[model samples]
Target: MSAPAPPSSSSSSSSSSGLVLQGADDVEDCVWENEGEGSLPWDRFGYVSDLVRNGNRAFRQHRLEFFEKAVSYYTRANQIKPNDPVILGNRCATYIRISQFLKLRSASDSEDRPLSGLDPTIHAELALKDAEKLVDIQCNSVRSFVLKASALLLLEKYDTARDTVISGLQVDPFSNSLQGALQQLEKIHASCTGSRSNTKPERTDDFDCTLCLKLLYEPITTPCGHSFCRSCLFQSMDRGNKCPLCRTVLFISPRTSAVSVTLNNIIQKNFPEEYAERKSEHDSLTNLGGDLMPLFVMDIVIPCQKYPLHIFEPRYRLMVRRIMEGNRRMGMVGIDPLTGSFAEFACEVEVTECEPLPDGRFFIEVEGRRRFRIIRSRDQDGYRVAEVEWVQDVEFPQGSRERVDLLELTSNVAEHASSWLTRARQAAQQDRAKYEKLLSLEHMMPTPRDPERFSFWLATLTKRRPDEKLDLLRMTDTRERISRGLIYLRAEEQGCRLQ
Candidate 1:
């Protein structure tokens, strides 16, 4: 009422609260006293009420608006408190999250060339530099460090990212996301090893995924007579369906037995312990046994379908023999992202049906069991080796896998999804139709309980890389994963239709 004091306030109808304040404000001051520091007493500095408001807004119900406000305010805040660790740390996080949303939006919004350069993931990074400035200011948050590492890694600053995450892990060891990020960087670096000729496993005490060499989970043996997690093999096969070890074709023509009696002699001779572990795990019934599955040192990717794995690679043949006589299950793992050997995450698979081929291969139908994420792979004597930690989301029956007439529900869902796909396809442009169709189906799956079958069915509809399919397969959370699958398939259908 008294001329608004220093006359810092203004009215704006476009924004939520019209009261925009103005005053003798110095951005370098970082903190501004409501009535001037002379009028108030405190070392209180490096923050402003506007910054708080913007931060709060960023986290509020209307997140988009909040983030927009944060972008402007935080940019101003960063300039003033550029070296203030707390301010820098917080601002860094705010930028990263905001940027993530923006980048994703830009990606999805821009079809021909999804917005790339100016995305928030980029801006969030600049904010991160400001955070690093806070190291001298003695302010760092675990969140800040992790985000920084993630940002750097995404930007392909692999070495710096790995170092930053390692430092953060020393400070906070329980950050699983950090662990994943570190592994990702290591995987990239590990790629420097020549080509497939260098694919030999150095040690077998701990097995590495032949493809990426992280940790193994849901480990799947390729029909080509090579073993790796479904995700790892799938990812490699995605580019060109080939064995990670021998470059043998996996999905083309007929898979052969590369494991000759000579190779079996090598494995048995080179590292018996690891070979025994592999054999024991493959043969043991109840596979990994109860909750102990996740606690194990190895992870695998398990597939839901069965193939007559009757190939006569003596090592694999013997392994399958044991698995079939018992649980009839195998694990699927990927190459470790760190060591680039075996990935830690994998799934436990149980065979529901198995029919031996006339050629001694196996044709089987299987269901997924426990899931795992690769942790660390250690070398043994001979066989490719490593320990895996379980990380997949396996739902308790009470959790998301409740028994129901899924077949009927999925049938109805598929029908609804198909209609959406057809319509969106017709409405969208040629190149856009497929993605849109997938999104439509994915968006609709949640309302239906039997979306699992629909999700898998939709999975079959799209010809994605094996890696993409495995991502869908690893989704143990029926409702959500299926929802994702529905969207992807329907979007593809729609996009194709439009074209």
Candidate 2:
């Protein structure tokens, strides 16, 4: 085949391919010349040559549609001769051109008639994929590196694009295209950094999450292009799956979505003090100090007990969502019948499992952890939050007479409890589900070495009144708790109900 004619000035004026191949003056220069053409069957060679000619001609036309046509023709050529370096490179360049055109076109240009095709990002991503394959197949080609770097640049990956150009320069230190790309990348990067550094600090709604009315911390940008603090967005999303700003129906959840790192860095770097303050405020809620916790006002819970809770109220649903995001722990407290207020003592529970329903409710399983004595209480966003002191049994020194006696007492009580459960399991065997539940509870028993925890586990073997559980939470004497656990077991064995 004869060498294709050099591109003319007239063709350049009407060319769409020039958008991506701006450094190259002619399309013929972009295509490798006569490398493997002789090896191809004549009929297949003629057909591929025709396809390439048509693609080159289509891209030289002054229409985006024609640019797409060029890509389609190159794609067919590629399918016929898989891994043809020339065809891949041409198709990759065409995709980059389409992406660049779409991205640079003014909104006003398409305001009247929306362009019906893949968006800029998708095109750029396609270009990047092809460019990557070209790099893998033609590792030594400067053009492959240039194409990949260009696609990455259009995708806004400046650092990676800069690195790609640098690597290409290492391959051919005298290549002007790579040198120019390196310079262009440095200038763009410097300008972006300089612009951010030079801009005056301004406090505006632009940096605040609409949901929280505060400086955005760990901001997440939705697919709809709206940004919010990650926690604030999910809190609002817990109530409804819609962008709080534009109400665009959101398909992302906190579990799947990630913080917008660039936007977050911009905000944090620009407004350091405000960002720090916002972070501290957020930490206060999510990581309350050792003595403080958000409280769930419901039934009493004792340590070493496990149960499921249905969170339906808006306040508790909000609390559950936050807890799941944070440490997955909260205080479970009940009202004091005498004072008609939250009980002074409560148990801390960790959410072991959580399932958020579509209707803004949570089905959660929690395991009681430790006890706390509320030193002060307050309302937070319609739920109870308390400053408390963690409660634990007063321990006798190890190897002391008191500790030895306590351990012996615990072993005796454990034996009694085991025998009682065996009988209870036998009695409940007629009901398969009840027997299974007892078996599960039996498996959860703690060792007598952890007498305090074992006492609570024993107490759970039988259903107790709310006030009785409250008393258990308040007791700091492990031996006393164990004695009470034994009494409860015996009472149940004797068919006596404690009111």
Candidate 3:
């Protein structure tokens, strides 16, 4: 080399001071000897907490570059002090922030927007792994367990989230975060009873409801192993209680059927767009009527009549809770054997009193209000819902003669019914207890001041077939129901005379 430029005074000074310049060979030899010993592990850990805070701030700014720089700092710290609890915790937190930031971005952007990079779930999974590592490294650290549980929750791995929570509680029972997480999980489980499907078929065809000829909506799985939209299946059942696909006999009632949790979840997860559209369509349909009302599938409710109920089932308890939340109104329909569903005509009832028990059961008293006929029906949370068309009495012709004739007819029917009731009670005297019970119930029967309504209630209490009662319930003309009642009463009285 040119004259190896004389080592200036530095060489001369090294000779006097016994200090020699390090050669490349010497530097290479010492590189591994004490690579990171100058920085203590604790120093590296100290930097991690600051890096995590900066990372959080960068994430808030939506500056991916700055966030990534913070992440790099954390990584450097972690490498400097491998497996340091503080470093591991900070790195895990950084990963979680990254995922959250990405998730927020995705939520704010249009659905059709193209993703720029890796999915946020990948980061969430990575964070979950880090959190698990932290938990394993520090078994008793409540913070570690909380972090792990949070990661699992974000991943939508609920069972593992629960396990993480239980493990944390085992270590420290008084952790408020862990307890709150556990309670939240329980609420989710109860509320979304029919959640995600586990054994999903490879093809999308498996999820379709046969009746609707599309994807299942509010799917309920019957005992026959076939799934259908709640409304579609109910409509099919209206013709006959059998599985639509398999034609298997089913004894399911709207009150007792449970929605398939697994299928619901799978549909929500895989077909989010379609599911959202379906939900919007369903909501729009249900809200078409004035304040959609829950349909109570039990005995018919007549206006001004008392409807006492003992609510014990979980589904009914939920229904009653919703009822109390709103106007305390519910529609009551009789179970129609002919249709295999509730009668088309129904009545609305308002809860007047409710006594809730410790076990979520209730003793509720209600009074009937107006009559309605089901225009359409659907299932909701193991209950029936309907779009209804209200029915009212056909007002008599606006004339004195029509009013007089109506009054005369109602009076004649009431007298005939009274005579027939007395004769029947006398005829049934051989069974005095049975006759006495009928007499006792007579006082409890609804007797409105309005003659038309009174005649309707009379027909309600009369010994008649279910179909006959349903006919009386559906009659819009109160006068017609009274005339029909007279004929039935006369036939009953003649039969008694023959006996």
Candidate 4:
């Protein structure tokens, strides 16, 4: 073999091919001279591959500079034979190493926690591009798919990463690498959703909230040297303005205090699995209704009336506490005396105010919002829960005779109710000293002009059997409720005259 000549100073030189060749001589010596031998591309590829192999060894030995040196050789080889899969794959592998090294180094770097110097995201993206090209070149290349998935995973494109792994598994069904990647993705999904994981528990105490003796969720701490789950503390404070453990008076309202940042971080970092489970559990309780609300079965609460409650039972206290923490709303179902469960129809109520008494009871005031018919019922935490679809007023067709008839009926009912109210007011006037409060009923009688409001208000004020009141509550048609109210008012008025 003839000795290779050193190039002139202005010509430049590249010794990556293991030969002293001028940059100007590279084209002629590589392609033209070695055309007959057909070893030019192979020689360049072999030389680059050797550099990449040595770079891999150096990477394992922590020789960081060798990555840059190997990249230079790979670039030269790629320029000589563009789009060569072997060269692209080797270059991509080197880039991946650089990204991994930077990421590992960044963990201890104070300037940035996950990245510094060269952004690993850029390298990972570049590796992804090369991996894509490789996959295009070799449709069934398992290595390319694995590499692409790894790069995507590093870039936090979890869905795409999982899909890529699945694609690889489709091509090579028994690949352990693909299986491992899929498992990692499942873990990530579980962590984000607060679902149970297959891994062992982190620590028992880390996951437990002191008040609930369950997993910590929306955890908060009090100034009285205590920490409890936010909902748990709120419930405790609702009963008595003191901490359950220390009985120290808590001046901070449950709504005002922020979540403990340090504790939240520790829980998220160390007990991700349990934290995910706890979050899922809380969501199931609070966000219960899409179309149906969780019902509180106890009384016959009519719409547009305030229902005051003294929550003392353990189950009911739990129910009210959940209501306060959630949307502050629940369905009020009357207990069916026949079946001992709950009536099929109920009115929804929203908590207007909640006063926590010192003995772990709640003085809660709720106002009715709407009515619903039970679709299903179950028991949860010792209280009856029902899934119910909201009952809206039946809208009569426009210009229909039904609407006109209902209007006429409502007017007649109102007149009779007014007459009953006038008679009651006169009776109270006959004894103003003893019946002072009944005087206000004269003015309040005509205030509820809305048929729905009027019907419910009449039910509350009128003396009626429980069954008859329940019948009014279950009535969806406002006209029917008003007709029943008219009958009740007429009967009462006749009784008053007889008395």
What TM-scores do the predictions have? 0.29, 0.57, 0.37, 0.48
The digit string of per-residue lDDT tens for model 2 on 1-499 reads 1112223444432133222434422233233443553244454456567888889887777357777788877865654465677887877777776666665554445344435523565467667878888889888988888888878877767788889888888889998888877877787678666645577667789888887788888887776788888777756766777778888765445333345657776888889988889888877787877877999988888987887899988788778867765788999988887788889999999986454554556678899999999999888988988999988899999999999999999998888888877777677768755754665576577889999999899899878888899999989899999999888888887887521
Model 3 earns a TM-score of 0.37
lDDT of 4 at 397: 74
Among all windows of 10 consecutive residues in model 1, the one with the lowest summed lDDT is: 18-27
Model number with the top TM-score: 2
Candidate 1, 1-499: lDDT as tens digits: 0101111113111021111101100112233333531221121132344564555455442344454465556544433333444445555555554444443332224333322123342344455565466433442445556656645543445577678778877777877656666666677556532243434556652445565553343344554555664333423433454566787644321111112233344455556676676566533422434333212122323333222233334334334444543455556454444566544356556654443332334445445555555455443221223345555444446344344544454666677666855555455445533543344333333334545544554554445544665465456676566566567656775554222
TM-score of 4: 0.48
Candidate 3 deviant stretches above 4 angstroms: 1-291, 304-308, 352-358, 365-367, 418-451, 491-499
Which candidate should be chosen as best, given lDDT against the real structure? 2
Kindly list the per-residue Cα lDDT of model 4 for residues 99-210, writing each as its tens digit: 5544344222412331112445446666777778877876697777767776665555667878887888899998876776787777665665564445644586755778
- The reply for model 4, stretches above 4 Å from the true place, is 1-215, 222-224, 233-280, 415-453, 496-499
State the local distance difference test value for candidate 3. 0.59
Clashing pairs in model 4, backbone N/Cα/C closer than 3 A: 194-276, 194-277, 238-356, 239-357
Over 4 Å off in model 1, which ranges? 1-288, 291-310, 335-340, 352-370, 375-457, 473-480, 495-499
Candidate 3 per-residue lDDT, tens place, 98-164, comes to: 4444434422241244233333444555567667788887899877876676556555566777787
Cα-based lDDT for every prediction: 0.45, 0.74, 0.59, 0.61
In model 1, how large is the Cα lDDT of residue 86?
41
**Ten contiguous residues with the weakest lDDT in model 3:** 21-30
- Between candidates 3 and 4, name the one with more favorable TM-score: 4
Query: In order, how many clashes per candidate?
Result: 113, 0, 6, 4
TM-score of 1: 0.29
